[model samples]
Target: MFTTIHRWGNSQAVRLPKGILETASLRENDRVEITAEYDRIIIRKATKKHLTIEERFEGYNGDYRCKEADTGGPVGNEEW
Candidate 1:
């Protein structure tokens, strides 16, 4: 679809159509890439950033599972 760039005070802006945004599954404030081709400009969604192990640990509480050791000796051992 063709869109026009209009003047916005000192900078320029483009009014993206709702249908186009919906078809692309884009949300407000989402990251986008603008590529300048020889004749036209291409806008595409940027790849999502993957979280690392350290990043995933941020604000994480210490919740873990542990097995208790057997207090008694061998099960087949004779009692004194």
Candidate 2:
């Protein structure tokens, strides 16, 4: 089947039919890759790797410290 191409804002677009999207296993926010070979264009889903929080932070150790409170009286006309 063929679909009409239309101008969207400053770009060209073609609305994908629901059946086509479903058959391609594509969903909302899914990443896709498009490539052109000679006179034909091909679009496919992008391969992505999902990592857990722990997997993302598998690194060396680091140190962090909090500042100590100053108990001195106000030295300026700043609001308390």
lDDT of 1 by residue, 1-80 (tens): 78889999999999989998999999899888889999977888988676799998998789877889878875665655
After superposition, candidate 2 runs with Cα above 4 Å error: 49-80
Q: What C-alpha lDDT values do all the predictions have?
A: 0.87, 0.84
Clashing pairs in 1: none
Model 2: lDDT to the true structure: 0.84
Those runs of model 1 whose alpha carbons end farther than 4 Å from true positions after fitting are: 48-80
Residue 57, candidate 1: how far off, in angstroms?
14
